[model samples]
Target: MAMYALTEVTKRFTKGRKEVRALDGVDLTVADGDWLAIQGPTGHGKTTLLQLLGALDRPSSGSVLFDGDDLARLSERRLAGVRARSFGFVFQFFNLIPTLTAQENVETALVPLKVSAASRRERAGRALADVGLADRSGHLPAELSGGQQQRVAIARALVTEPAVLLADEPTGNLDEDTRDEIIALLEGLWKDRGLTLITVTHDSTVARRAPRIAWISKGKVSLRKDDRRAARSRAVTTEPKDADSAAVGGAVATAEQSAAPVTTTEPRDAGGTAPGGRVALPEEATAAE
Candidate 1:
């Protein structure tokens, strides 16, 4: 079943006197339990598209169907309900409240759903354990390492038991080693929980991990199926000098596999007019709060 279906979706922003179209006539469908990686240059509408999917923002025109309901037509209250109950989001920066303990940070996600305090605490504890952060539940974000803080953020996102996970630049701020650890954790969670995972990343290494890749350019999108299974097999079987070398080798192998013939689907009228200027939007603040 299709968890999300976007047809002729376009998002526009008014900057000065000129209108900037971040997403132009985008058409894409993501199936339930599918993993989709979106990669594109900065200011090219990757985040705009993700915002639409997560119900953080509405489109300027066209339909954004989530499980057959048109999000564009929904009232703001209904959209907020959908976001609170159906979607979980992890951002690039660990957006944990500095004063809150790890468990407390996670519990906040349940507050909007009106979960009892005791139940929220219990669920938050379990979520931290799921992300391998149970031992650090009492620690503040300042006390934890970058990787641990990201884990706490992940835990917070999952505490609501959302059906879809929307992550934007999830590993962009971490070291390569930490990035790998976080990605592994997310991949495991997606498989075990049957989550519909959608991640937007600029890193090719991260993008290649997904079974399907959506390349957005000039507010247009193209979808391609990747042979990640074969690439993973090659990475595991090959021996490298060190861990870093192994990762690089794996990326190379994945790139090679991607170069091979694969099925690709491009949106109708994919060509879009380039924006005269780009506006940097603020990070999404709803997920953790």
Candidate 2:
């Protein structure tokens, strides 16, 4: 089944007398069980597409059919229900709750599921374990390493068992080594869980992992299918090393430090995993995980 189909979607923002159209008339589709990498130069509507898919924004025109349901027609409360139960996200920076333990932070994603707290705690622990953070679940974000914290965020996202997994620059904040680890982990998750995955990135390293690439420009989507060459030719990961200080983790993490003209940084500062999008300005991030 097609997981998402966009027809002539458009998004515009008015800045005083000047009206900005972030996404132009665009049409696209993503099938079930597809792992897609959304790639484009900056100012292309990569993030805008994610926002539309996540139901965070309504298109100014056109309609998006997700699993046969029109997202534009959903009520606010009903939309929240769809997002809560049907989709999960991973931000670029680990958006762990500062006050919660790794376990508690991960469990937060499950709170709305109405599962028992004990079950949440258990599942959260297992999710952390899946990401190689089993030993750090009891620690607070303060006590864990950058990679470990991001793992917690990933765990929280996975806890929901959503049908679709959306990641915005899932590796933007970490050093090269950590970035590679994160990519490997995502590939593992995609395989193990059979998720319908979509990630927006300007990183060729990350883009190379996807079997298909959807390039967006000026709020319009141009699709590319079955790009196995990138997956095969770009097997090695790109990353340097972790920074030595936490200064890299604060405002500079997602606030600044975008990659070059063609390079896009993963925006995770808002705690919404899918943050540095090319199609539009990153969505006003909602809840974490």
Candidate 3:
């Protein structure tokens, strides 16, 4: 099943009396439980496109269909509900609160859900454990290593049990070893939780790990499948539990054969010249996470 279908999507921004078209007539479909890595040069549309996918920003003209609903037409309240219930996000910066303990930071994700304080703490603890930060739950972000802090950020993202995990430059701030560790953790979570994973990254090594890679340049996107990675995934998980599982597997294989350009160029910042700020969220929600 397709988790997201975007068609003719365009996003425009006004900066100092000039108009910037961030995304230009993009059409793409992301399958459920699919891991897609987006890469591109600086000042292109990678982050803009990701913002659209996460419902952090609306398209100027066209449909962004999550499941079957058109996000472009949804009210802000409806969009916020979708964000709160369906999507989880991780960012380049650890984005943890300076004063909050790791546990408290993870618990904030549940605040908008109206979870009781006790329930929030319990779930946050479990999330921290899942990310291998159980022992660091009481530590402040500054007390943890870079990798551990990212793990805490990951825990906070997953505490809500969202269907889709949207990450923007998640490993940009880490060293090579730490980056690999975070990538492995994310990969495991995507497979174990059946998440629809979409990551915007500037690292080619990270992009190659995904089953599908999407490259955006000059506001347009092109997609290609990573056949070698897909084959490896199939080999490791041979037995489909049921007919439905087998069918979905077949569909993914078929989709992989559809060709598009594959870029071997080194990844660039992709942050572009757009304005910088945290993702838009309600006051109670952590804007950066």
Candidate 4:
């Protein structure tokens, strides 16, 4: 069975008195240990879809099943426990607490799991070391560079030992060199730890690394071929407006093996943050999106 599956899921929201359908009849299945990339333009339900997959929000009309258990049917307390125990999320922004040291920031994730102080500290140190931040564990977010801060955020996500890692624009805020480093770290962790990685990214550099690519547009989700050459070529030749149009239309075919052209320069959201930082509930997600 698929590790996680969305069955005709539809997610709707109210934006300034207008009902916005973020996800409409979206069907997706993520198998265990798969590295899946979800790509699309901003405001095109990518973040909304991630919210559902991570159990941060429930679909409006359909089911989000995790190992065949329906998330919508779980109680709020149970859902919170599931999120803490089963999933790790890394946001585009570092989302680190300003005052906490890198190690302390990572230890925060263990608080809900009721880990002992000694065990939490040990695990946090190991997690930070895994991300190549062992020396920087005592530094605060302000003391570290952007890349270091992001690594700390990643360490925090890892401290929980989650089976799934949900990263939204994991490399969006870094320079080219730093972005490559972070991507390498993520890829290594995904392979070494046998984690199911679900990344929502616009950067073709990051998206192409995943073995499976899925496109989300107009609230629909469909699999597409992972073709880096085609994506890079389109990025060079097409105008932004025309590319956006083609992106929406070209990848929605039924057969699903056809490759869709991916753009390299997608417009970034202001503040360099995604709609939701980490775990967001449905009501909170409506405002964030």
Candidate 5:
């Protein structure tokens, strides 16, 4: 059985007097322990698809099922539980807290999982060390370079030992030297930790690492199985422009995988922080004050 199955997924949103179709009738099944890469221009709903997969947002239509449970049916509380216990997210910018020490920042992601304070601290330290940041744990974010901080973020994401690592443009901010290092680290983790790594990137080199590729365009997703024609046939149900954009977070989906294409970048916070930093607490999530 597939680890995740998305069927007829459509998402749309409205912008300034314009409707954007971010995802359209997307269908995919990501099995366990698979390394997958999603490629497209910046605004082509790559990030939006990640959001849907991570259950940060529900599909406007269709279904996203984890194991066998439909994410749309999950309450906000349940979704938070699933995210905390099963998913690890890595954004391009290291989303560490400015005032917290590196170790403290990494420890934050573990809080939701109800790990004991002492155990969490120990595990967090080891995870940071794994990324070659053992000594910097006590330092603030400003003290570290961009690459160091991002590694700390990676450490935080992994400390929880989540089943899936969802990274969106994780290498976008680094220079060539650091970029390759981070990629190698991720690949190593993918192999050693046996994680399901799903990354969204415009870089062809990055996408090529994936064993399977899925393309999004219009309001549909095409899976590139053995036959290219079968992929095109799946798009017969693409939605109209208006409904398509507004539903999946407001951009046209593109099935044509571009090795590199110009994309209107999203407004990244100067701090590289995501919109929702705190994982909402549910009963299943262990939250400490």
Candidate 6:
């Protein structure tokens, strides 16, 4: 059975008199240990989907099942437990606590689980070391470089040892070189830690690394062609009438409008694992709704 399955799920938001439909009859299945990329243009429900997948939000209608337990049916307390125990989240902005050292920041992930102080510190230390930030563990966010701060954020996410890691635009804040490093680290962790890795991204360079890609458009999802040759063939055959419809909200036009553009990045030789991603803009949530 799939680890996560969404059945015709929909999410609607109402603020004042305005109502927005963020997800429209979306259905998808994610298998265990699957490295799935969820990509689309801005305000197209990508982040909303991630929120639903991570149990951060509930759907308006239909079902969201994690390991066959319906998230929609869970009470808030139960849902919180599921999120704390089963999932780890990274966001677009580092979201590190500025006052805390890297190790202290990582250890906070264990606080909700009520882990003992000694065990929490030990696990946090191991997680930071895994991300190659053991030496920087004593440094505060202000003392670390942007990349190092992001590493600390990643270590915090992994300290809980979650089975599923949800990353929303993980590389959005970094320079080109740092973006590549974070992507390689995430891919390595997905492999080494046997995580069900799901990422939401706009960067073409990062999307191509995933084995499966799901494209969301108009609040619905469709499977993307992952093979380069097949994608090219489809691009060549796309209807001329669809060209204008492809570009929206100041985004660039691509043959596969539903899919994020797939661009190549130079090969990286790094082998270590890390965790990273920051929450998207606050507007993203309301926009999705």
Which candidate achieves the best TM-score against the true structure?
A: 3
How many Å off is the CA of 140 in candidate 5?
Answer: 1.4
RMSD, candidate 6, Å: 12.6
Better of 4 and 5 by TM-score: 4
Candidate 4 accuracy as lDDT: 0.79
Model 5's alpha-carbon lDDT is: 0.72
Clashes of each: 0, 11, 1, 0, 20, 8
| lDDT, candidate 1, 41-112, per-residue tens | 676788888888988778899999999999999997898899889999898877888999999999989988
Clashing pairs in 4: none
Pitting candidate 5 against candidate 6, the one with the higher lDDT is 6
Per-residue lDDT of 161 in model 5: 88
Order by lDDT, highest first: 3, 1, 4, 6, 2, 5
TM-score for each predicted model, relative to the true structure: 0.82, 0.78, 0.84, 0.80, 0.76, 0.79
| Winner of 3 and 5 under lDDT | 3
lDDT of 5 by residue, 63-119 (tens): 999989899789988988998889988887676789899999999988877889999
Could you give the candidate ranking by TM-score, starting with the highest? 3, 1, 4, 6, 2, 5
For 172-244, candidate 6 gives per-residue lDDT tens digits of 8899999999999998888778888999888878988776787776576777744333333333444445655
lDDT of 3 by residue, 1-289 (tens): 6889999988887888988777878998998888899977766778778888988888889999998989889998999899999999888887888899999999999999999999999999999999998999999989999999999999999999999999889999999999999999999898889888999988999998888898887677777555544544574668899999999988776665443346544334445453322355553232231
Cα-based RMSD of candidate 4? 10.0
Which predicted model would earn the best lDDT?
Answer: 3
Error of 2 at 235 (Å): 15
> In model 2, which runs have C-alpha deviations exceeding 4 angstroms?
228-289
